[model samples]
Target: MENAERKELELFAAKMRRWIVEGVYCAKSGHPGGSLSCTDIICYLYNKEMKVDPQNPKDPDRDRFVLSKGHCAPALYSALGLKGFFDINEMKNLRKIDSFLQGHPCIEHTPGIDMSTGSLGQGISAATGMALAAKLDGKDYRVFSVLGDGEMQEGQVWEALMSAAHNKLDNICAFVDHNGLQIDGNVDDVMSLGDIKAKVTAFGWNAVEIDGHDFDQIEGALKAFNENRGSGKPFFVIANTHKGRGVSFMTDNASWHGSAPKEEQYNIAVGELDAKIKELEG
Candidate 1:
């Protein structure tokens, strides 16, 4: 990426982190760790990868994205708001009693959500189905999704993977947010998803591992996904990320997985992110 583009992405990701902290703090409950971990990918997708229009969010030919790791709705929702799907101030109402932006994605309510997902391994299944449907309909639109590393333990996820590869759904690209931590202390401790890349490759996906925080690597892997469109195989990107990124106390800490920050911690997080944004601007 060019210096200007990289700087723009950095600033956007910082602002999104602030939004994540703000929403969770105001709601007094959420999964901030994974949300922060995946914010960059969401930033890149909404900014550079996906073909989405805030004015016509449901255009049939537009690319589709599913947050397979749907608990991180704060990140996805913020990306949508930043891209003008709705008012960015709407984030303050996240998870509120009457807010359309609930804790998880709901396609019925949210404009940019292509799939309503929160039930663990089901999002990938839906994405795979969407890919197959697109092929059947002779459409060129692609399907993109993100999965939690801990969610790799699900048998249903493997089933979806196998089915996608078996049917050669090359139009689909997905990533594993391998943050090494889940709500439980560590993902490997709770359940070891040994050699995630190898496992998915064995399942017949064209897979690659990369630093999830790095925009260049993310774009490279996504380019590889695009190249595989006619190769009769699906693409899986194993993105190594920190569970709680962009905040001091929360970074890599599993406790922040399903808990909101207190007022002091929230202030600290917002302060740090604001500083980063300022530096990027400078």
Candidate 2:
């Protein structure tokens, strides 16, 4: 990415962080840590990477995105709102009665959601099916899915991985948010995911590791995936990220995994995000 484009992405990330924080704070019931941790990846994909149109969301040839880690819907919703898929004001209605934005992604309720997912290991399978359908139809579009490190523990994830590799679904790219923290506690304590890169590679997929928060590295990895498409293998990106990135009190804290910020803390987080946004905009 060029210097100007890089700056634009940074600004987007800053605004997304603010949106995630504010949206969760307003709802007073949602996942904030994982949402914030995954903001950069979501922003990069929605703003720069994914070939999507908010106006014509159902365009046949548009790129597809599946949020395998559906609990982090706040991040995705915030990105979609900023991308004009929905009004930014609707963010306040998150998790409320009759709100389209639920705690988990629901395609029937939300626009631009390729798959409705909350069950841990199902979204990837749906994405795999989409990729296979595209291949059968000889479509040029690509499919992207984001999975959480904890969610990888599910058996269905490996099943989907095996199927994708066996089918040579090179048009698919899956991103693992290896933040090392789950809702319970440290992932190692709950369940050790030893050598994620090697594990995916062993499944016959091309795996690359990158700092999830670094826009340049993320962009480069994505470019490599696109260039290497049709190499007879799927692409997997292990994004090493902090659980609660960009927040002083939230970073590396598992308690914040599902906890909403209190009124005072919310003000502080909003202030920090606002300052960063202003700096990036300048």
lDDT of 1 by residue, 18-63 (tens): 9999999999999999999999998998999999899999999999
RMSD, every candidate, angstroms = 0.6, 0.9
Give the per-residue lDDT of model 2 (tens digit) for 161-251. 9999999999999999989999899999999999998899999999899999999999989999998796989999999999888888999
Candidate whose lDDT is highest: 1
Which residue runs of candidate 1 sit more than 4 Å off their true CA positions? none
Candidate 1 clashing pairs, residues 3+ apart or interchain: none
Shift of residue 265 alpha carbon in model 2, Å: 0.8
lDDT of 2 at 72: 94
Among the numbered candidates, top TM-score falls to 1
What's model 1's TM-score? 0.99
Candidate 2 minimal-lDDT segment of 10 residues: 14-23
